[model samples]
Target: MGALMPAPQSKLIVRACVGAAKEAARGHTSRASKEGCANFEGLYQDSGGGVVEVSQTKCNIRARNAAQRWSMDANADGIQVFMWDVVGTLRDGFISWSNQATWVILQDAAEAEKKGLPFLPRRFHAVCGPGNVCILREEREQSCRTRAFASRSE
Candidate 1:
């Protein structure tokens, strides 16, 4: 039997254009803790061990949990304009910008129609190609706090 190989980590970074919808921004990565217990000296301690619960409240739950959560939220919220711009370097000595997560964008658009949200500009157009320099522009404007909230599908 051959040894099992681990799945490769995604090289892509999925960034949302708009901000979170406000309700999702409050208490983000700010409120999180583990269960407590008494230690040898009868002092209060985290019984859950040193297992510090990372900010589980963040909208982005690492790469592992993002896709599933995003999909469910897309289905529920009926997202309107979800798009992706991919950037990759070519070994042929050229860089390129392409559509990577376009399928996810379509699914989100369909879900948006099902949920009754604005579904337009669902297509993604390339801005610039790969290189040492990459300048990006966002059509959807939002603050960090708002963006965080907007990104949340919940």
Candidate 2:
């Protein structure tokens, strides 16, 4: 495991502790995601991933990470560590109070294809940003309809 600094403009998928947060926000008890995950939601909204119900355009990684810390300190780890993709150029390639202190950087794009998809267990490698480390210990693949997604011009 390596570590660097989190960058601006990142996409992160985290399991939101929606039970309490939801109850507080909407005044109703909420259930976990259908996959038996605690709201495996994305902070950044993008149609790139087919998980519609779980995907959003808005970002809230900072809020979510802070909440997860609060949960761990207050209780056991309420949120599960799910895999994520965080890609962006950092402000100074170092952690700072003004920016996120942690990063979950996946292998560079060129490196990923060379060793097969980075999502594969063996091929997976990441660097934790400054504050702490985040790794994908295990992942449950969620199947989706690929045809619905427009091919990336890149």
Candidate 3:
């Protein structure tokens, strides 16, 4: 409906925050997704597809025949404390973040409309992992990689 709604095949950006998935659902867009969508009904069509699978569980609700086939080794807490990038497509009204079919992850919600942060509408906040901020990016013509540690000053 607007640029904020993002076009299909676009990337999503989630900025993580601490809150209940239920509250996050109530606090998020009216679209219906999975998990945290406990209280919100009839407000928005069940347009969003796929459930967000956890890192350890190796689950994806959108895949018709997806199997749990990822290694659960190498747990890192550092990834939990900061934000990361997720490249996904917005089909219908759903989002599926994937690593070239490696593993698909889902978010309980997107865009904290009430967060009141300058970056709120520009990012996605999901129930994935430690609730860290997630940013879906636009597919660039050129691939690039940049890494930064928040402990260090910009």
Candidate 4:
């Protein structure tokens, strides 16, 4: 007798994942679905040969604005990546800070000053002039730090 025919694979399964992260915060997390397959297909004309293969993948993502700080957990495999876009002006913007270094420095300085102790001075460049010149001054300061960070990566 002929051998029994094998079961046909289902062609309606789909895979998807969704994630959300706060603006200028650290350690982003994702939510996963409990019922979903990794592949999908629909009725359509064959491309060339008799058999056909189809697949569809989706990812739902949401993110907020970054005011003073931003952070996300890196994947172990280094495959997934994230990016964002800014909108509107600073007057309508919201802010969030995640890095602890800023707080640590402020706390240490406050304690030292209370005891009449000498503390190392921390300096930051700022725009003092008015009008369009202010924007140019801000850009110059940003470029300095950007160049330094990019060079280290190389």
Candidate 5:
């Protein structure tokens, strides 16, 4: 028999992951905001050749005119990643931080997608602490886990 096609839900997860990465790259290469923070929202092509919308915002209390803090919206057809007061610039550390966080979620999501396993939309929060370490927690769960990303010299 021919290989089975990935389920619709699985495809969406894979697409969202790819789209999230694209969005992160776009945010990184665009510019170093004069405000020292920016809000990025755009469409990205997914792994399966589909369009996915992604949005992100980063802010720091120490930054100039830092109006917004940080927020992310959950979407069935897209992905969102948010950071608050991350310690470095887009080229220096933000890209790596965002990618690492994306990969953490994507690792599980991709496995389920590859296996064609069913999945429900889930929300995750990644909070970065000292030493560039982050804790990712699912919105529904009480427990938290730690993941570390390399920190670039500022």
Candidate 6:
């Protein structure tokens, strides 16, 4: 009989952040030690991992439903004009701007409804600010405090 030959070996290298690399190295060392492997050699085995499947059609339908819900809510609040502007911004590929504008418009609409005042498109623009960045309430308060302290020091 002919002498048997050993299976060929291959190395797998992964590049990640420092934290992730350290975590992976720790797991590998633990597994190697548990299996009593010497110098982590000849211990490679392929475990069939399950694959995750996602349906693109379902994703699209969910996104459309969310948009319709937002539209209906805005219309009910008499703020469809502002919603249309947000839709236009989204269509123009300014995703971040659209998100901020939508959030500001919705918040204003809710506040106006609570106070029995109408939400104006002009108010939406003012709250959204230039470049469509909305300063959150916490951030606005922090800025005010900083300015007050600076004025007092001066």
Considering every candidate listed, which one attains the maximal TM-score?
A: 5
Clash total of candidate 5? 0
Clashing pairs in 2: 45-56, 45-57, 103-129
TM-score of each model, in listed order: 0.24, 0.19, 0.19, 0.14, 0.26, 0.17
- The order by descending lDDT is 5, 3, 2, 1, 6, 4
Candidate 2 wrong stretches, greater than 4 Å: 1-97, 118-136, 140-154
**Pairs of residues clashing in candidate 6:** none
Task: Encode model 2's per-residue lDDT on 1-40: one tens digit a residue.
Answer: 1223234343222322212111111100022333332322
Residue-level lDDT of model 4, residues 52-102, one tens digit each, is 111123322222112223332211111122223311111101111111001
Residue 66, model 5: lDDT of 14
Flag regions of model 4 displaced more than 4 Å. Answer: 1-67, 72-82, 86-122, 135-154
lDDT measured at residue 62 in model 1 versus the true structure, 0 to 100: 13
Residues 1-154, model 5: lDDT tens digits? 1212122122112222221222222233333345444332333222222222334343321111112232234211112223353322233112222222122222222333456654333444344344433443435434433323332322
Cα lDDT, all candidates: 0.20, 0.23, 0.24, 0.18, 0.29, 0.19
Those runs of model 5 whose alpha carbons end farther than 4 Å from true positions after fitting are: 1-110, 142-154
Cα displacement (Å) at residue 32, model 6 = 47
Error of 2 at 147 (Å): 38
> Could you give candidate 6's per-residue lDDT for residues 18-114 as a string of tens digits?
2111111121112222223211111110111111111112112111122113212221111111234443111111111232221111112233446
Error of 3 at 104 (Å): 16
- Which TM-score value belongs to model 4? 0.14
Model 5, TM vs. native: 0.26
lDDT of 1 by residue, 50-92 (tens): 1111111222211112212322111001112111333221111
Comparing candidate 2 with candidate 4, which one achieves the higher lDDT? 2
